[model samples]
Target: MTTMFRKALNALPRLGVQVVDLGPGAAVISRRGRYSATKVSADAWMVGGGRRSTRAPAEGWGLRKAAASSLCARHVADFLANYEVNCVFDVGANRGQYGRQLRESGYRGRIVSFEPVPDALARLRKAAERDPDWWVRPVALGRSESVQSMHLGWKTMNSLLEPSAYGQQRYKRFADTRTTQVQVRRLDKVMDEALHGIANPRPFLKMDTQGFDMEVFAGAGERLDEYVGMQSEVAALQLYEGSPHMTEALAAYEEAGFGITGLYPVTREETTGRVVEFDCVLARVSSVPGSAAGVRP
Candidate 1:
């Protein structure tokens, strides 16, 4: 099919045509016009040009949004609405997937996304280009500040920790062990700068740093209390060496006064159908400085 499309493109008149590869799921070629490519499913692409519909085709981040809205977006939306969240610190925001889902869920608050991978960061920046409230930081948040080697995994599965042997076998597609050095910072150190001009910053944290969610949370230090709600990826089976277990991470959050709001499965073991990880949503019900006092609706 791609060959036929290329042949057709070659036969077209050189009428100042331009082509843009809109990431893995879509591509667009136009001559003073616009086109859209929607990923209807994992292996399908639907391309269209100029259209108006009550429900537009999912493209790029919209594809991710559609996929997430079906799973955890509703819960996340309720978290934001319930807590009156004003800003979101999207830790490990690969290509702004979480941010896009936030927008899709009708949360128009500020989004500060942090990512380290070069290619993913490029796509993430592009996705946030037009949104003044969406900010992208090309750095990984961790327990400390330093330059660390990030283990490259499949898609958004890259991590600061090495992949475990069982993890490698269980997720063969994520077994690529390439490494890239990226800047790592403690969130507390950069918090002021990231939220400089934002007023009444009732922050919500959506952490999906592969298996390093706890480290990112640890990096928040005393500033951790500034967030009203959080979503962390908890691994039931260790996917990354040195990653905290599900119980340990959950206990830590509970110890920090966060109560469970929801637990959404992220992946399941194929053979046993057992959950491998979960998107653990938690909220602080107590009145805090970041929420319930002058926070915007």
Candidate 2:
């Protein structure tokens, strides 16, 4: 399409036509033409090669209050309720989405959020400012403590690792990235600092580090057992370079004596209906604080 025509299409929102940008080199879609527009866009993408918008409706942090009522969030609420968790360590807590969702889910515990990217950390801090129990730490968690280069992609996609070819091709936002130096710390080294004032802490670790879950878990080291429950993002395919697959991370957690409590898909391939990644929740096997009705074996 010509630039002039594209501009005109983009201006359609003023005329009651909701235009959604599908990303670079893809066609824009109007609300009414969504069905046909998607089909044509998919075909064009396959032939000319363009990334899909991996952003999902559920990913809208602003609508997290609505999301908290979802089955996945309810599962989390039930987990916290049954286990009596008192604190949460939210790793890769971009803009405090998880922590806020926890609150909306009726979790009245302490939350310590860790984030490295300047843009996200600022927003995360602002989000947590009014909540006295929510704290923000401006450092990324990794296997070792050091200064590392973080690849800043579209806010939610920022990561310590570069996006893989598949990742870049799968999501338009992942293709655009700029690097920035960030402070990385091992969780073991900062555990005391994170839990400083909390007495009798029963912590739950929630990790969504854009394919760096295992690295963050490794950073917890032998102190991992201090957390009663844990959640990690696992992928069926490599989104970040050198990232482990789902099996590797799951096996490692299983070996560490945690059993699966919930596995929720984060995203999926539209055409193939194949899950791309998941939020896997696990709890210490023999140490579950209460009855195990919904908890998976």
Error of 2 at 145 (Å): 0.7
Cα RMSD to the true fold for all candidates = 11.1, 11.4
Error of 2 at 179 (Å): 0.6
- Estimate the lDDT of model 2: 0.79
The C-alpha lDDT values of all candidates are 0.80, 0.79
Query: Per-residue lDDT of 1-297 in model 1, one digit per residue for the tens?
Result: 567666555555465675655554445777755556555444545555554444543343334344443546777887798777888999998988888878978999889999999999999999999999999999999999999998875787888888888788887866557888999999899889878787767888889998899999999999988878899999999998999999999999999989998886777664465778888889887733455653434
Per-model TM values vs. the true structure: 0.74, 0.75
Output the worst ten-in-a-row residue range by lDDT, candidate 1. Answer: 57-66
The lowest-lDDT stretch of 10 consecutive residues in candidate 2 is: 40-49
What lDDT does candidate 1 reach at residue 112?
Answer: 94
Off by over 4 Å in 2: 1-69, 290-297
Candidate 1: what lDDT?
0.80
